[model samples]
Every structure is written in C-alpha cells, then in structure tokens.
Target: MKLTTTSRIAGSAALCASLALAGCGGGSGSGSQAQGQIVDGGTFTMALNADPGNLDPQSSAASALFTISQLAYDTLLGVDPAGGQIRSQLADRWSAAGTTVKLTLRKGVTCADGTPLTARTVADNLTYVGDPKNKSPFLGTFLPAGARAAADDATGEVTLTLAAPAPFVLNGLASLPIVCAGGMSDRTSLAKTTAGTGPYKLTEAVPGDHYTYAIRDGYTWGPNGASTATPGMPDTVTIRIVENPATAANLLLSGELNAAQVTGPDAQRLDKAGLFAARTAAVLGEQWYNQAEGRATRDPAVRLALTQALDLGQLRTVLGAGQATPPTTLAAIEPLACPGGTLASALPAHDPAAATEALKKIAGKTLTFAYSTAGGSAATATAELAVQQWKAAGITVTPKPQSGEAINQTLFGTGDWDIAWAQVNVNSPDQIVPFLSGPGVPDGTNFAGIRNSEYDAAVKRASAMDGTAGCATWLEAEAALVKAADVVPFANQQIATYGAKARFETPGQLIPTSIRMLDR
Candidate 1:
C-alpha cells in the first residue's frame, strides 16, 4: 500500500466519525493472552452498549454502527496496530499520489450473496458515497469528499480521483465499510440485512436485543489477508445489547459472555477477575459547548467560564474512576496516526471565582446540558458533578442524561442542547474538520455551529503537508480549538474489551477476524 498527499497529509485524519465515547481513539493492547487451548466453532458473544438503529454502515459515524460494521463489512485497506502502517484488506495492491488513488482487487473475492466481488462494485461504492446528494455520512469521514471513481473490470482495478488532497486517504479507506452490489441496489434493505464481502454474514437481526452472524467460508481477505477458515475461529458472532456495564460484567463472569467492554466501577473487579483483554487507550471524557445562535454558550466568555467552573482534574479522576489519564488530542481512538499534541496548555485554569463573575451575563438563564448515558454510572456522577460546579459558579444549567441513540438525535437532529458530552472520535485531526468548522446542523455535520477562525486557518496549512511532516501545524490547529474553548477534552483511559473464554484485538473497534474462542 502506498499513500501520499501533498507530500501524505501532515497528520492522520481522525477520518471516521465515531459517536461512541469509549471505543473511539488511540491504540494499544494489554492483559494476559492464550490462556487455554484453542476451541473452534463456539459462539462468540460480545455486549454492545447500544443498538445501532440504522444498519446502513455508510450512513452514520456512530460508534455502534462502526462496531457492528466490522462483522459484516470489508474496507479497501487497513492499518497495522503496532506500526501504524497501511495494510491490505479487500484491495490487494493500492496507492495514492496527490489526489488520485488506484486499487487492485484481489481475485476470488465473493460477497455474502454468493456473487463474485468485482471492480465495478468497488467503484460504485465509492461513487455512491462520494456524491454529496446521497448524504452518506462517510462522504468525507472515510471516503474523500467529491471523489470520482472508474473501474477496469478486465484488470480488477478501481481508480479514484479525489477532489481534494487528503493525508489519511489510505487509512480512512480502511474504515469505509464497502457495500456489495446487492446491498447497493437495494439500499434500504441494508437497514435490516447484511451486505459486503466480509468474513461474516448476518443471520439474524433483532433490534435492542441481539444481532447474530455466521462466519463465511472460503473468506481469506481480512486485514493482512486474515481468513475465516482458521481453527478456533468462531462459527457464530453474537452482539447483544446490554446497557448496564455492571450487568455486562456480571454476564462475563458468569461464563455467559465471551467478551464485554466493562468501564465504570465494575472494571475494577473485572480486572481482578483476571480475564484476557484487548485494551485501547481513548479520549472518553470530553465536553462540547454549542455556539449556535441564541445559545448562552455561544459567547466566548460563557464557553470559557463554563469550562473554568469545573475542575477537569477532579472530573477526569471521577469520570474515569481515578484510572484515567490526561487526554492528548481531540482524536480519541487507538493506534493514532499523528498523536503529537497536548490539550493542556490551551485549556483554561480552573477558577471558580472568575467563572462566577464571567457568567453574570446570563444571570438567571438555565442552559440545557446533555450527557451520554452509555458511560454508565460514572458518567451520571460526572454530569451531576458538572452541574454542581456550574451552579456554584452562578450558572443555572439543567442536566439531561440520554441514551446513546437519544444523544445522537439531540446533537445531530434537533440541536436542542447548550452543552453535550458527545464526541467525534477518529484517528486524525483532518477528519475532525466536518464537525468543527463546517456549516451547522440541517446543512452540514458541524452540529455545534462552531466558528473558530484560528482553527480553520491552522487546519488549512496543516492539511497541505504529507504524513507527519506537518505535525506542528496540525498540533497548532488542535490548540486553536481548545484555547478558544470550542471543545474541552478532559480524560483519556485504557478502554478495555474484556474477554472471558476468548481473546480479541481492538485497534479502534473490535476486530471481528481477530476473535478466537478458547477452551477454558
């Protein structure tokens, strides 16, 4: 794989929009491994924090969609966990120069419908998403915006002509869940059915309950050419929806669940239980204040005072249960492409007295605040603490805790919020452009209606360079956002995917192909 833009983007584009708070950024692995003999054909059940309502993988940047997409979709390329290098998946050979990309499809690839995977199908997937009218959320996140595609079936090649230069092009392509020709034809069926040339095929779908998938035979095109026919590979994958972290932890200890992401207070006991884990460091605690018209947070003073009122150090300790670390960047997932920035110096010092004085502008007005309930009990306590801090600063803010789905609607749909805990977790700073500096809701993904001229100008200069060559400028761009109080990133932690009778991998989302059922 060869990826270059204006010399490779100076920083990796946290390209994919992940709505999940935990599974979004940074990369690493820890815990014991290979505890027992490999066991084949057993069911691998993992707990999903929320049900991905829309099954269309290309439609949402929500973490739920990103997680489930891993099971039934295949991307053009992938990123290596240890080295941050590009790896092949569906595409055998691929390269990018400036704004043009070329991909060579591997032979003998087949979709879930038993149809051969062709170059046309690959090109069509890009075309469909590249068209802004289609409104695919992946238009710029995973696939470059306004990119055009051409297919040469005779040679199994798909050529992409991007409208703009992108540094993380190859890495971003690794995250775009490519659709099969059949699914592309009947797009709405994707809402409940499976489509793609992935290692697994969806067998059953019950919203808010469990999603079941069966491993596909003769599939050998996972990241780094991983295969599904290997021994110890699960015959079935079950993603069960369990909202409570403690309940999910209980299920894991009871031998009912093979895997579950247990955060909150429950993680402490699970760690002592000695289960094998695939850990990922991520920016799990973040605050975004809406700066849209008529909102109190729109005022730079209000945004700064709100950020100053709370002691981020204490909140990080509380939110992460005293095990969290200081966050480094806005990009939250693991194996970060350009993890060379700090959110500290840019943040305002905790000053309650100054906050109380600054917030006098909106004396009696109550700000509508929302937090994602997916963070479990710790998140509830964190939001409550924030409310108390704000109140003490002479700020009247209403705290509203919402489920993962409700949080998405509140942020992207109605925009009826003053402050929220939602995040746009990706691996690159360039990928954050849509959420930070574009048109607001009803027009673009910039849900908060942010208007940071410094961030906009800095990102332009940074995005012009390739690879980490422009690292300083990219860091400058991130600093602009934080220094202006447009976003408040507080805690980073080792978000672990605990395994009971199983072992897996998590670069960002849990790798479906890396799961191995164990005979304990």
Candidate 2:
C-alpha cells in the first residue's frame, strides 16, 4: 500500500518561519495575582504550546498540562522519585493483599472548597472512574474490573478491592486526583474545578489558552517523598501557551519565561547557551494508522513494509542531539522492555528495495497521514525522510498537519486516516495495552484499531504472570500486532526536560504538578 506524502508537499512555505510569523512567540504573560497565595513570593510561569484536553483527569489522556495538574491537585498516591515506589498523599499509608487494598487517610486535610478530605471522597473518586458510564479511557488499564471502594468517614479509612492482581495500580492511582463528593455527583462540573487535597488550587483555566493556579496554604497532605510543601515559593503558577519552540527559546534566553519546551535545533541551541540545564526521559513514538479507513494500512503487508522501512537512527538524527534514543521493541527500552517475537520478525529490514517490492504488491493505493500537535522542524523533517523512503517503494503518501483534537478524532474519534504520527505516554511497559489487545478499540490511546483474539489472550496471560514469563506473553502479542500490520512503532522517543535557573528537583516522570521549587 502506498503512504500519503504530506511533509514534502506541504512545505510550500517555510513551515517554521510561517509558524513564528503568526504571533507564535515564546510565551505570553498574564496579569499578576493578588497577595498571599500558595506561591506567595514570585509567579512560576510555564509555557506550553497547547492547553490540556480537559481538566477532568479521567477524560483526558497524558499531555503536558495533565502532568502539571498533579501539583495543583492531589491524588491518593503518587510515584516516589527516590525509589520509584508508590508513596502516600491524602492517604497516609496503603497496603494491598491479593485484590484488596486498604488506605489510611490523613486527618485534618480539606479540599479547596472547605469540605473535609475523607474516606468517602476517595471512595467516590475511585468509583467514578471505574463506572463505565463515565467512559474514562484510563479506568480499564489502571484499575481492575470489579474494583470497589468502602469508606469509614469516622475513622478516615478507605479500602479498595480489585478483581485481580494489578502491579501498576499505584501508577494509575497517581493520575487520579481526588475530587469532592459534591463535585463527583456531577462529573461534568468536577472536570473544571480543583477540589482535591493537593498543594495548589486551580484558580482559573481558559481553554485553548492558559491556566492559573495558586497554592493551597491549608494543604499539608502531600507526596510522601516531597521534602516540604512550602507555601512561599511562587504565589501564582501561570501556564502560558507558546506553540513555537524558537519563540520559546528566545523568551527563555531573555529571562521573560521560567520554563519552556524547546524542540529540534532549538533544544540543541539551548544546551549550548550555558543558561539552563537539561534532563531527558524515555517515551513511545507511535506510527499511527487508521483501521476503519478501509485502506491498505489495515492489510498486514503494508504495515510490515512501513515498520521495516523506518530507520530509527535516521529518525533520531532528525530529532537532533539527545532528543531520543533508538528503540528495538515497541515498549519503552527500559527495565520492563519485552523481548523479540513474531512482530519483530515480520518487520522488514530498513532496505528501500524490499519496501519498494512490498509497495509494488499493493500498488495504486494511497495512504493518508495525520500528525498531532505542532511538529517542530525535526519532526517535520523526519516525516519528510519517511516520505522519501516510502515513495521509493511506490507509495504516494499525503501528510496533513492537524490539531491534536482533529488527530484524536480521526484515530479514536472517527477512524478517518490511513496512517498518522502520534506519541503515547509510558512509565511502565503495561502502558502499551491499547495497541496489543483485540475486539476492543484500545481505550483512546490505540490509534491502529487493532483487534486480534490471540494478541488479546497473550497480553492477558502475560499480565497475570511475572518477570520474563509476562514479558514473553507481551512479546508474542507485540509480534501478533506487527504480523497483522495493525500499528507500526518506529521509535519510542525521549522527552527533553530543560532545567531553568530556578532550583527544583525534576520528577522521574515529567509530571509538572509534583515539582516543588527551591530557592538557590
């Protein structure tokens, strides 16, 4: 099947120059806040290109904004930075035996709205996410079926019961910022407020623009590993929307901004400037294709050809220095990374000749490509390189630059594209569920619309088992996915974490809300 080429054809104008010219400055400034807030000294300004999909933790997938919300909102538990274990938050301590988990809530904690933070609030929040009616994309992956919460308000105790053993429970719970019962009663309303027992409170959010937060002085319940939740760091934390990396770099250099996401050559330039430090984390870069599009992408041959054609090193070069690491497996190339299997074998070598022959088999088919978020020159350049290789195999690819909303709609939304470029957040290997399972349309993250009973069975078997056995099951499942040509995973990219002059420890996972700034 032929891939649609958009990157090369769409560059009629210098894409970077046009984006910069369109008022895409580094970051914008909002008004200062009133005195005596959680951040009481200076305002911590963070510039992001896009606003989060929603404040409703359950409804939205992982994004730059979702990471930040954790600081403003608190979850029952959070991942510990020092040892990578689950740590207490509103719930002081927690233990699990089999599928049953008990939590001891911290007393004297209250929500921003004045309601006491109790076991009932924790119960309600857990139940709300598990309820299918809510249609939360994260529930099934993070929470097990038959999960229920029982709370004793008087004792400030809550117990969680799951259908089966879940090792990644804490990682999932960390994303669930506790909400009030009143807010939980109306899911739609709760999506916009900060009722959790977190350190910061969401003061305002202007969708598609920026969000504002102030420290909750009454908040003493925090992540167990946090040194201290001092209420005097920055009185206000404002997240400004700056879509252009060049503009963001400039602003950062000028000291108009505190932190910004620099990409492509811009990121390299920043490292050389000696003004800021940098950190990097591994993440997945998914080569998404639409299964419902009725194109060759649904055919195994086409998917295999594309996966084989991908030279990860080439892609990394396009990403520039220290932006990404080459990945051999679809999972994060870390401790839990699964081994080789059918999927790995089915992927063709990075030989253009073989790709051309495979394309010739499906000649006359055109593939449509969609990309989420604004691609810096590097991503665009990588796409261009991919197009050149695919064209050699006789494929005609049409690449389209669409908003993250539009891209999500096409894949998980309406299933309209033949192929697309997308990024998935992963802290552990289990996060690769949507793409490996069958019958179900992989909760919102599954862009390929993969469905295979074998693949599903393998993933389940692996999940119940431990260590290499489980990894083997997932390996087989990944092979099945590759063999079926469901989704093509090229590179599991790394996220660039730029350290600003403001002193603070960066979390292992790039969750913005969990970070606490320390004065130098």
Candidate 3:
C-alpha cells in the first residue's frame, strides 16, 4: 500500500494517446456548456470498477479504498501533485530536526462525530498505525517502524520520534489518513462508517453495490486550504460499482454517469465521443519471483533465466497496445520523488540464448506461475505470452489464473506461487524500502521473499541523505536489485477517467478535494 502521487492535471495529448483514443474534445452534452460555471447543488454519480473490500484505510492496500477514504479522513500533510511538495492539511505547520518531527494542528478542526480534533488524537492515530501489534499494513511502509508520538493538548502540538531516520518521513505522513479516536478504538466500525475531519460524511454503504456520502456543512479544513463551501462542490456523491468498462462508458455518454474510469477499447470510444478525460501514469507490468525456500524461483539462476527469456519489447507492445512507458523503477507513478534513468542500464536485456544456457542447469524443473485477471484481457494475454516464452526456454510453467483477491491471498497468505505478475506503485523510492529489504509475507509486504544485503546496504546509504540528494544512490541501489533479477518492472501505462458533467484531479487515484460539479 505504498502511497503514490497526488492528483495533477495531465496533458490532453498524453491522455488521448495513452487510451488509444483519436483526439480529445468535449462531448455533445451539457458538459461542454458547463466548463467554467460552478453549480450550487447536485448529486454526482461516479462508477467504480469494483467494490473496495474494506473501507478502513489501515487494513487494506487497495487504491480504491485510499481514494474514497480521503472524503472522511485528512492527513497531517498534503502533497502538491505537480511537484511532490508537502503541503499543510490537519497540521498547519511542521518542522523536522534529526529523527524527530513536530506538527502543529490547525485551529477549529473537528471530526465527523463533532469531536474536536486535538494533538492527542493525532498522536493516537500515529501510535496506533506505527504499532506492529495492530497489524496495520501501513506500518513500516507508510509509518516508519518503532515511531512513538506524544501530544501537548494545550499547545496543539504533536511530536513524533522515529527509531531510525526516515528520509521521506513527511511524504509518508502525508499519506497516512488520520482516523478519529472513536474510529481507532472500534476498528470494525471503520469498515462501513466515516469518522474523520474531511468534508464528507458517509450516509449509506451497501457492500458490492454503492456507497453514498453527504457533504458536511460548514466544513472548512482541507488539503491546501480547500473547503466544502467551494462552488461546484457536490451536495451528495454516489459511488456505484459498475465493473464493465463498456457499460460505464455508455452510461457516461448517455449522461447517466457523471464520472467513471473506463479502460480498454471502450476508452477510445469515449474519447471519440469527446468526453473530458483525466490521465495519470502508473506501473502496470511488474514481475516478482518468490524467493522463499522450496520455490523453483529460489535459484538465482532460474530467476535470471526467467526474466531474460521474455521479449520485453513485444510483451510491452501487447500489454500496453504499444503505448507503455518503459519502467524506470517501482516508483513509476508521478510526481516521482526521485527521478532517474536507472532502467536504461539496470533492466536485463532480452536474450533467449542466454536464458536457454542458464536453464540447462535446471532443465527439468517445473514452476507455478500466477497472475490476476483484474486487468481484464490484457492481463490474461500477457500471462499466456509469458508462458509460451518460458516453455520455449525449456521450463515447464503451470499457469494459475486467480482473481485479484485470490492472487493477494496466494502471494501473501499461502505462498503457493513461484512467479507472479504483481505491480507495486509508489511515489518515492523510500516507500518501497521495506518491500525490498525487510521481512516478507505475514510479517511484511515483501511478499517476494527477496533478501539482498547489498541492496539493503545501498538503501541505507540513500536513506541518510535528503530525498532529492539521494537520487543517484537510490538509482544505483535499484540497479543492484534488477541486476540480481529480484524483480522485473517492464511497463508503465496511463490510466484515464472520463467525465460527462464533472472534472476531478487524477494523479493515480481521484483526489477528493478536486472533485467539482459542472453546471450541466
């Protein structure tokens, strides 16, 4: 659940080209007429591709959960999507000295339950998420391990002490949604309720169907000083689960759906129809090998061989419809905290001969390959192609198709698969440190069971420096991982959302603060 980029507007050409669309223009509807004008009240209907399994931000790593959680909860900091700079949210001001960070809470902030938000409450949220006993997925990933927080109620200041120096501490804190004390106490209630200081309150939640939110009146505190009273702010928002992309697009064209993320061929049709679309770059093609004992991929030679067998150029073409950006690192989502050209030198060259030579040492070994169908046809096709390539290289591959949930269960639960098509998108290199260097499976998000001391050492070196200053060292560290074939990040694709009568900021997920109702 590494937090990626904040929502920023993308170029029209990039948006249209990524979706394989013809061109960009407003559709023949009220949306065209409603461009600049803001309406007072309207019910904004959005189509979600799938239902978020849990609403508790601490429990799930799903992007959908993070997007919706923004409506109810606010973090101490916010990110400027254009530059990845930290902005004030719940915390009006913050200062970091050594391994300690001090945050000053904003005035007049209150939770949805009418409880005044205090430094103590903020401290409680941090301590709870940082504690390993709570089994928060964000622990070690978003919140640094062994972080202790203390609050001064009278001064509205919270002090966070970290066990180790975290380079991107502020960026990590920006992604940690602050849950109210009541919600934190009763974690189960958070699965279907809202209890934070955001602009919306959950009114109704029907699992696998829809979740509705009503705007909170007099709500003023928001990221970057945004407010609920802003013009075009929706009085109500209905997020309807409509999995079919074509259906969602048709609904958008018919003016039934105000906003929806439509992928595949349907996106082209929507673009041709001239609907307003927002796009963001995200890593889509990533391969991880299970390095745990007893797995066929445990052998470094086998892992390297498998990676080298694939025709990555052809695979990228097939997976991205020839529009994929060659991956630079796992942190491909923009606004990248550390940008470099590591991929040009780090990624393994596609050489079937080299793969064949390496495979001879373990010629008869069979491996189980798992992939999720969550990406629809493109995912299935890519898996099949990989299987063919692996077979040609003298390795027997047992293709196992799993639903997204089942894939997560198998990779992190049963540990049954040897190879996986898993995508890990993060905004900063430090966010992926635990996944690459720490414990694996039930203990951590490093599901691949990778343990490279050299890579870990490089990461430690990079962590000591400031975020931007460590780019060269971070890129070198990533190269170590790729050179060892610990993971293969191949393709990054653009994801777009079509709007019929609304416009919202989309970096990786829709920014709740940016949603605006059009006067259609």
Candidate 4:
C-alpha cells in the first residue's frame, strides 16, 4: 500500500523544441546536469502532486515535500543532496562524549528576516521539538530520551545531553530545519511560508496549487558541503501541483512545464515522443500490517503468509515503467544498500498455494488490510491491486481509500487498523533498532507496534560495531524482525525524475549537504 506518484519524464523531441522556443537553449542533455545554470531572473516552473500538510519542522509529516522546504530553510546540519551523507550547515563543529553532544554554531548567521541565528534559537528549536507540551509527532523519531538542550549564547554553541548513548544523534539533528522563531509564532502560517536561513527563500505558497522560492540575494552562509550561493538557476522556481499522469504529460507536451514527473503508461508516451530523459532512484516500500489491533494479522503466521504471497514481479509490472524494483534486502537500492547475504537472499517468493494453506490455519478470523490513497490515484490503484492479489490466497483484504492524513491519523494516532501499508526509511542499520526493538523506541516511527527483546539486543550490537561487521549484525536483526513478521517489506520504490529533453538535467533527490540544480 506504500504509494508514490513521482516519475521521471525524459528525452522528448517536442520538449526540446519547446524549450528552444521558450529560450531555455536547444541542448539535448537537459536531464544530466546537476547545477542547472540557466542563469537567474526567469521563473523556474516545477510541479508537485500535492501540498505538504505541515511546515512546523517539528510537526511536519509530509515526507515528500520536507526536502523541498529544506532548500528554503536551514537545518542544524545538512546532507549531501546526491549522497545523503551528514554535513555541517548551521553547526560549525560537533563532538560527542558518551550521551552528551556539543555543537558549536557558526557566527554571524542571519535568518531571512535578519534576526541573528543564535545558539538560544538552536536550543529553542530543539526544545520545541522535544517538548511534550508541543505534541509534536516528529518527537517520536527524534529526541527519544531524558534529553536536555541548552545553549551558551557567548560561545554560540548548543549542547545536547541524552539519557542514554544514541549514536544516530547527528542524523536526528540533521533533520531539524531552522525557521525564523518570530515568523513561527503562527504555526499554521509557517506551513505556507517556509521561513528559514538557506540559499533559497520562500516567496509564495498556495496550498494544493503552487509554491514559489527565490534565491536569497547576497546570501552567503553555507557549511562545508555547499558552494557559495551563485544565484540559483531559475531566479524564481514555481512548483505546479499536478496529480494526474496524463494531465502532467499533456502540460509537458504543451510546453507549460519545464520539468514534470511522469509515471506508468505516461512514461511510454513521453519516451515515444523521443524528447525526455529518465533517472531512477530507489525507495523502500512496505506493506504495513497493523499487529497491535485485534485482527487476524496479529498472528505472525498470517502476516508471513501475506508477505510470501506478494509477487514482486507482478507488482513491478503493475507499478509500470521506472516505478519500482524488487528489493533484495532491507536497504534495497541505496548505494550502501546491503543485500543481507544469501540468508537474507532467501526472501519468500510469491507462492499462492502456501499462502492459501497459511490462511486456512486462521480460517475463522476475518482480515481487513487497510490502506490510504490520499496523495493521488496511484496509491488507490495500488491498494486495490493488493486486495485482489491477497484475495487469491484465500484472504479477504478490504482495501479502503482514505485521505493520507486520515490514514496516518488512524495508524500513528489511534492505532485503529488491522493492516496498513507504508514505506519505512532504513537508510542505516543504526536506525533499525528503534524500528524493531522494545515497546516502540519511544517517539519512534515503528508504528507496527512491535516489541522484541532479542531483536533489540541485536540492534544495539549492530549499532556499536564498525564497518561490515555492523552490517552483518544488522543483517541478523533484520532477519529476526522479518521472521517475527514485525514488518513485511515487499518492494523498493524507484525515484523517477522527468524533465524537458533540452531544458536541464534532472538530479534524482537533491542532496541537502550540497544544493545542486540539475542542467545548470
């Protein structure tokens, strides 16, 4: 049920001619460059499937648009846009001693409104995210402990004291995008105005319609990973929200868009036009089975059966061109993506007969496999397909279409689900323990409600180990989780970037550490 609508549209003859007429130059390598150097002044037209639900940084749950917002806002730290490795942004230098970490902030930094970026502001941001009074959902994945944050205004440094040793603390800090404390007074308004201190500044944002960001004029405050602000390619970048594939394709054909995300059959149409180029990125997709509720899926056997019945090949075909990949491991398509060995290699193949037998064991219990399709029609269709496939295995899965907010509310809020599908972020094994371990890693994203002591122990060991040894230990933990049916990771989603053939190069996901515009 984990659904995504973004797809790459590349290599179109008509697109190139259109770009030429639009004065975007007549080059055929539009989808290859990273630093899109179209010069400044003209508005960069872009598109998104939906609007981001929140922008509080602490309460924001829309994963799709957070990165986009990150461009306009500055996090305590940033990651390479292409590589996704931790890099400095606001913090100048950082060190860890046991569970306490100290961060020294770079001086003379200013917010978009010209307020000095102070250590107190840094502490406030963390304190806000960590505060129970705030009721921030982001707290679950971050700030998990008897953690304390304090800033030394004189030294321009902030120190975090953790209750226990948390190795991935930097990763968590990297996620807290800083916004002007003054502008954030109205939390609702923050969503529309992505106020922060980064290369780009928000100019306009109309929910579900479009958003605009302009380069911060005369701005020069970047960490080691970023180049000095060189006036972002399109002086003004406009994101047009289009959810339908055909309409997005049609818009591209009419030259209304410089970049568009195309998927399914639409990719074929653009490719046949011979004017668009495509680049594929991978995302881990999971068929989240809610085990907390009193449902037939609470039995691990039923969950295992459903996992085994999934036909990765069929899912890919249904997913259409450049939409998916059959994941071999928890880290599937990541560069550091570990295969988890042959033991991990022995993933259950699609076996309807075995699945049918497994379902018979729990014949009396009715199963409800629930999923939400609020983001777009693609998710709704994907959920329906899962329902049909599961029915073939003698399991009755009722596919439901709720708004993304409603579905997330039920799954993460009330836990009122027999089964729901989602995609888990397993970028590192260090992140696995909280997802699989005890009574939910407090404020953790493991919404499946799994609590395994042995798995927790294994994850701790893996997190401490260095190099390949750590990966092996994580592999063990992954196996334990899979065997326990804690989570059923079915496939890895492919990140598709589409653009006009001669306009610019399309980088998959922009690395936060480095802000590189494609086809510059």
Candidate 3 per-residue lDDT over residues 221-331, each given as its tens digit = 776788888888889988887655567778998999988865556677777777777776666577789999887788998899999999887777776766677877666
Residue range 1-520, candidate 2, lDDT tens digits: 0010110000100111110000000111111111112333567776665445567655644344344455556677765543456777777778877677888887787777788877887888788777766665555545654689889988888989888776556555654556766667676775666656666678888877778888666556665534224534566777776666677778877766666655568776766765443233333244655655456877666777776666756765675444554444554322333434334354445766677777786788777777643446666777777777777668888777665444545655666678776654344445456434532343444446666677778777876774345766667776666556565554433334443434333342234333434342
User: What C-alpha lDDT does candidate 3 achieve relative to the native structure?
Assistant: 0.72
Q: Count of backbone clashes for each model?
A: 18, 17, 1, 35
TM-score, one value per model: 0.94, 0.83, 0.90, 0.80
Candidate 4 lands at a TM-score of 0.80
Per-residue lDDT value at 458 in model 4: 79
Candidate 1 weakest ten by summed lDDT: 2-11
Candidate 3 residue pairs in backbone clash: 27-274
Q: What is the total number of backbone clashes in candidate 3?
A: 1
Model 4: per-residue lDDT, tens digit, 1-520? 0112122000111110000000000112323323344443456565554445465545533433543555677767744434545667788788876678899987777777778888987787777877766665445344544578999999998999877676556655665567666755666777667667776777877776877777665456665635334433446667776655577777866767666655566666766665444343333245556666566777778877887777756655555444555555554323332444333344566788989899897766666655533223444556667778878888776665554334545555676667665543433444334344434313544556776666788777865654345667767777777666666555454443456522433223333223224343
lDDT per model, in order? 0.76, 0.55, 0.72, 0.54
Which window of ten consecutive residues has the lowest lDDT sum in model 3? 16-25
TM-score, prediction 1: 0.94
Off by over 4 Å in 2: 1-40, 225-232, 321-323, 328-347, 438-445, 466-472, 479-485, 492-494, 508-520
Scored by lDDT, the top model is 1
What's the CA RMSD for each of the models? 4.6, 7.5, 5.1, 7.0
